[model samples]
Target: MRLRNIPGAKESLQQHPSIIIPNPSENKGNWKAVFGNDNPIHVEVGTGKGQFLIGMSKLHPNVNFIGIEKYDSVLVRALEQAKEEERPNLKFLNEDVEDILTFFEKAEIERIFINFTDPWPKNRHEKRRLTYKGFLDMYKQILVKNGEIHFKTDNQGLFEYSLESFSGYGMTLHHVSLDLHRSGMEGNVMTEYEQKFSRKGMRIYRCEAKFRA
Candidate 1:
């Protein structure tokens, strides 16, 4: 997706320190201090527009939600919408996922949500996929043993590739859905892309994979 550069988007994001964390790497293992509670923290890797994360924060008040988006233009939209609601449990990280391990120490994260990420269909670009083994290894470092990754996408090829990746990594899959909207699952928060795709009659795939204990 081509992102249109928004003027002052970076400045707007910086203004909201309470919502957008500054010097996140410094927080490291002190995320509990950042949130001032011991509530489990859940992160969304590519939180486009923050629709799903925002809705989740409202639905699960006890869980701390942090959204990691690299682009200032895209992240600013989430920061704007988040201001309307006073969510002490929600925060944003304007950083690349490549350094994700630097922001949080081992076992710091409880759950991860990856929704509608780029398919990167080329065979050579397989390593760039979020579900790639390399990316999964990064996730394993910070996630608690038995921690879960909940992934959703409209791309069938990526879904198939991810299933194999997860299985190959010895992760156990649960609640797998080939067509999420028709799966009768409750309390599923839909991302902006998910809603748009569903409106166009696209099939949505979803699964929850857990690291071995």
Candidate 2:
């Protein structure tokens, strides 16, 4: 379905004015107050085409979702799905993840999902990957004690590097899987990238990382 033509999307989003953060720089420090809910907040970094975010929003209504995508062209689809589902619990930010801390208050988030993030495949570009220590450190500040980061990707090197980064930062790893689709992992929801890669028989990697309390 085309995002722009999603029926009632314009109106539904208007009623839920806070669903889109217009000026993330100005409001990131007080996001919880803007959301007006104490429900656990979960973030999906690199949310593409909105499939996973939309699907998970439907599955978990009590938990609020904050989808961050740098490209507005991609984020519009997420907004459309949220409107179609009337998912009162979903919001979106169209900005780079580097400034993610600006949009979320300290200890405001409980969980984070990193799905199919760009695998900067150069030795020098490794620092640009979201799983790099710079980004993870930002996440640590916004996530409460023991808050977890869930990562899924098809890139082998990125996955291996992420594991090392997490370990070096003293993160506790749980529910780790090297070949997720073949690991007998049940109840795993498919994201757009996961669906495409798995259909072509590509293996997936996944893990749950948490700060040690």
Candidate 3:
């Protein structure tokens, strides 16, 4: 984060009491109500510093958004961004994604976004990746049939590995781009990391996986 965005950031995070999920399990099936919307729900896993979800919520008010992050420090920064944006349709969960199923019922989530997720490059830590089968299985339980997962990363290894994982899970793949910024895909929301890395001319890999019914 820039020094310009730091001042008053702490106070801004305290402003939205309802947006922070203190107990994720206790909020089971209550996410839609939290945003005060019955529309389709879109969630962002590992919302580092909050730029992506807040930006998306600002542009698309009709759709609801929930950002989940495990690190309190990281989440605090992201929460401040969401607060600064004053997004009515955006909320957050400060917990591990393993609790996502308990917080949402079957087919409750309509779309999921995983942007610049941890690559977990080591073979021993493969399960920690958000696209890992364990995590995908958990996502599948809550995602509606035809629900989709959007991902963008600069890691070729993770991108290739994730495509195989999605295929293994029988997902329908679309928009498989090895260099997203140069792929001519318009209307793309750039995350803080994407903006930083893309400026250095790194090719960004992206894909969307739909869990077919």
Instruction: Give the best candidate by TM-score.
Output: 1
Please, what are the lDDT tens digits per residue for candidate 1 over residues 68-185? 9999999999998899987999999999998898999999999999999999999999999999999999999899989999999999999999999999999999999999999999
lDDT on C-alpha atoms for all candidate structures:
0.95, 0.83, 0.86
* Model 3 per-residue lDDT tens digits across residues 79-170: 76666777788888877887778788888899999999889899999999999999999999989889999999999999999999999999
Counting only residues 3 or more apart in sequence or on different chains, how many pairs clash (N, Cα, C under 3 Å) in candidate 3? 0
Q: How many clashing pairs does model 2 include?
A: 2
lDDT of 2 by residue, 71-145 (tens): 656766677777777777788877789888777788878999999988998989988999999998999999989
lDDT of 2 at 18: 64
Each candidate structure's TM-score, on Cα atoms with residue i matched to residue i, is 0.99, 0.88, 0.91
| Candidate 2 clashing pairs, residues 3+ apart or interchain | 28-102, 28-103
The true-structure Cα RMSD of candidate 3 reads: 3.2
**Whole-structure CA lDDT of model 1:** 0.95
Please list the residue runs of candidate 3 whose C-alpha ends up more than 4 Å from where it truly belongs after superposition: 1-15
Clashing pairs in 3: none
Q: Candidate 1: list runs displaced more than 4 Å.
A: none
What's the lDDT for residue 140 in model 1? 92
